[model samples]
Target: MKHKRLFSEIKADLTKVEKELDKLLAVDDPILSKTCVYLLQAGGKRMRPGFTLLSGRFFNYDFKKILPVAMAIELIHMATLVHDDVVDASLTRRGRPTLAAGWGNTVSVATGDFLFAKALEMIGKIDDPGVAKILADVSVEMCQGEIQQIWSAFDVKQNFKQYYYRIRRKTALLIGLSCRLGAMVSDGSLRHMWLLETYGHCLGIAFQIIDDILDIIADPDEMGKPVGGDIRQGIMTLPMIYALQSSGHRERLGQLLALKNKKEAQVQEVIHMIKNSDGIERSRTVVDKYINKALKHLEELPKIPAKKALRELAVFVGERSY
Candidate 1:
């Protein structure tokens, strides 16, 4: 069997899809349009859009139709990031100054809202009420997830279950929804839709788990942002939670949390402690579970090139070091 990375095999299609994303996001107003385009230009893995296209392959395989949905999905994602900067008080994304950093909170928030409105408008043109509803509902869940994260921030007393729920809503919901919507757009069977939806959900959870892991393990240059960012913000992730709960470092973690200084040296120590402790291993195991669950969904899909590509994507998520 010939093996090719999904994106590499579909390079031409992906390129056109990216161009459509650029076109849809173009705006006339200098400030709002520029800020909106800035974040898109900053670059992302474009995984959401990738999933959108891959899932669509199961049905109509129309890049023209799929591109708008992909752009809308990305816009929804970028909007959340802009708002997230304000909520996290973050200054940088992908190592560049964030909208909140240069434009101030009000402008950033309004820009996010504008992008969201644009996404909704695009969805309205899709002509599939079911697709429209799914996208709209997932947007709600995404917002709710953000609100939940804020509510749970710095609350070390929270458990793994609460942490899982937060990530699922905030991160996984859209990914799963993207797959589901894509499958719907392609006119895929209900069984395929269910499988793809589940696959996207598991992959999304794994993605977020990797994100948390990289916070401690990845180099700042590679990550395009500082490590220990979540720690500096006092938000505890799975690895941190596992380290605190499973290891005997609970007291130490508590002490670090109580500190007001939070110097770079101290934050590095906390990161080192989390890394060297059982936290990274435990977090890796958690990711493995999601990866396995994702693979199980793939088993039901017909054996084909796209299915093989998706399987590799899942393993790539769990096994990727950076």
Candidate 2:
């Protein structure tokens, strides 16, 4: 809420993105349309599109050119979420049932594939071969990140470096690309594009770190899923990684986590111990570090209104209440 004005500046542009997204996702099949529309109606922060629009403000602010790329970036994000729901078998997202939870996995997977293909179609409209290649690389990196998560599931022995790379691939790359493509479409200076990418990458990493933290402490009603859900699925997030590396309760936490699958009660017990330990604090500190890194990039931008909003948006995401 603190940064409402940041979004307000580009309210019209965002509305256009919403309309464009609806048009893109529209299909002939009733079931496919119903399923896809259901997921779209659940809605999201639309942060990807917002970032794309704001970054474009650095140059000519050509809403005409930026719209296509913004919509495409958001479409990719939605596609990833649809696929993630299938992989996680998540019951809920944003306080609503997930696609895989409400419909079957078969439909959900198809919906995700549809979104991915449609996103590429929008990119093709731009007719920029370079943009298409960049997006393709992002898809590859994200898949690699998902594979890493799958391989590392339930393994607590891994270090912070692995976790950092995983988040960078799965989350940061898309965000950075959003900023880059926004600048690219407007033909902004190469230096400006680089700065925006740095800002986006740092802000994205911070965004995910806080997200993982929220999975530990946020109320189920607000978070759309039960707290400690990641631990239940044996995903070792940053907070748990820090707590496991702690000397005091490291062994105890490991023992509890090892039994999380067989003894469900251990999930809450591990959550409790993690709260009591230094894990949460340390993770929060790391979140601040990345946010500061983003702000460093923000500082170099010219005295544009978008720059202020970008700085505020970066800080708001790092400290978002939810």
Candidate 3:
């Protein structure tokens, strides 16, 4: 089934929420308003909002009703990115200057806070304490994950367990919450909600694992960022972990990590070594494990077109090249 098109069907509803987000964030300050609008207009995959609406189908499919929840989840995600650009010192996203790069760090930070506050305001409009509670708790976990990632940087000894735990908080938790709250806002049964949440959790993990691999394999034009970014930042993701496990390349990996300022030549050399060191295959294996678990969760969901779309989504993440 071509579930890729499923998201397109909800394009109208998603666009509506996008408009609401813009209206809510309308500020008087010219620079601040421009920065916020610039980021919003650049747009992203809108994957969190997609998760919310898709999961909403099993309970009560009302785009108008659940739009606030979907928009709130997306705002939370955008807020994280606005801060992440500051943390990573990123110059580009989606092939354009980041807010922090264009504006200043101070301005960027306040804008992120403003977006986050807007998200909270939207959540309050929903009037569901359960949804509000999960969002607040997940926001804290996301912050914790970011902190741990920053702390662990340049530590070559960091292991797979630590890496997994960090990504679970940074990436997977919000995606899972997006789906869970999507179902709740739609009034899904407990069982259905749980199933969707499980699907989101495993799928989110798989998505990030693939993203890590893409960071190593994709070109800047395709990935919309410089290659070897995580490596350059001294962040060891799954592929790097598998590379470290190799007895033969331990010394080489150490040399690559120990370097203070890595040149293009050195980064390419390490990239080539990692491509041949079975690290790529090992990371793929781990991703498959999570994808299988996600498919299992899909099997338990009610057999509907939307559920089928979710299943195809799992497959797409595992196989997508971009």
Candidate 4:
């Protein structure tokens, strides 16, 4: 399997990352430590950190210097997940009860805050205001994205531009930061850093689009939630947006979404309506576009093993289901 192959190639470094993450999460309060560990252990591809590590490799930078930045990127990602679960009222993630589900919202939120603080501490060790400013800007964009998400919920009138920028703020900015900062810390050329940032941004947005598709079609066990989860939550993802715009069932979908609380059958109806339309295929088309954009950025970079691995990583991003 490519999964095993990928891990085998990066095993030693990833092990270091895992240990660093665990050490960083250890805290004074047992409850805080336990909750943070629980969330971190919830299985994920760790793709953000993986991208950071790969970008760092372009300069063949010291792994020790890169580790703190890579770890900080991952910590930010995990922090977002914890807060996201509470915001979405998600009960399960990766088939385990969420921090919000196992503990309460307050505890979950506090744990997320702790993670953010720790991430900032790691950034502090770098001792660069420029780097701190980058994270600060991304953090502001992320909060704005969350606000936009709440306002855009169940919104049928939303256009392509609105959805595009929302996902950029929510996912792409930090991903771009990871790659750019990886290069920055590696002392990469400005041209190389910006190119990597662009690559990361395109890849991250595509990743989110695929995630939404998986939320519709992937197995519950694999997806960590039931199908139609977004539909039930009234989040208008790309598939749903396309369906609302083009599917003949738009009226019925609109009617269903009008309800303050959509029932199980109604959510199912919307899901199938989306699948039966051009939504899934069209959404894939958009994913492909972003991926192509990423590949173009890679084209400008020097031919190196890390660059090849990044290309493979881009393919993996598109093919990955969970």
- Write down the lDDT of every candidate, Cα atoms only: 0.82, 0.85, 0.85, 0.83
Clash pairs (backbone) in predicted model 4: none
Q: What TM-scores do the predictions have?
A: 0.93, 0.96, 0.95, 0.95
The local distance difference test score of model 3 is: 0.85
**Candidate 1 positional error at 164, Å:** 0.7
Per residue, candidate 3 scores C-alpha lDDT tens digits across 108-214 of 99999988998998888887888888888999999999999899987889898899898999899998888888899899988888888988999889898888898
- Which residue pairs collide, candidate 2? none
- How well is each residue in 1-322 modelled by candidate 4, as lDDT tens digits? 4643454445578778888888888787979878977876775777677777778888867787888888888888888889988998988888888899999899999988989998888888775677778887888898888889888887877778888788998898998888998888888999999999999999989988998899888888867677777787777788878888888978987777655588788778877888898988899999999999999999989887778888887888888643
Ten-residue stretch with the least lDDT total in model 2: 255-264
Give the TM-score (vs. native) of candidate 1: 0.93
Candidate 3 Cα outliers beyond 4 Å, as residue runs: 1-4
* lDDT string, candidate 2, 122-234, tens digits: 88887688888998889889988988988888887878899998999989999988988888887888998999999999989999989888888888887877788788777
Off by over 4 Å in 4: 1-4, 7-9
Of candidates 2 and 1, the better by lDDT: 2
**lDDT score of residue 3 within candidate 3:** 43
Model 1 C-alpha lDDT per residue in residues 17-63, reported as the tens digit of each score: 67776777787888967886787788777778878778887777887
In angstroms, how far off is 302's CA in candidate 2?
1.4
Q: Can you tell me which runs of candidate 1 are displaced by over 4 Å?
A: 1-5, 258-261
lDDT for predicted candidate 4 compared with the true structure: 0.83
> How many steric clashes between backbone atoms does each model show?
0, 0, 0, 0
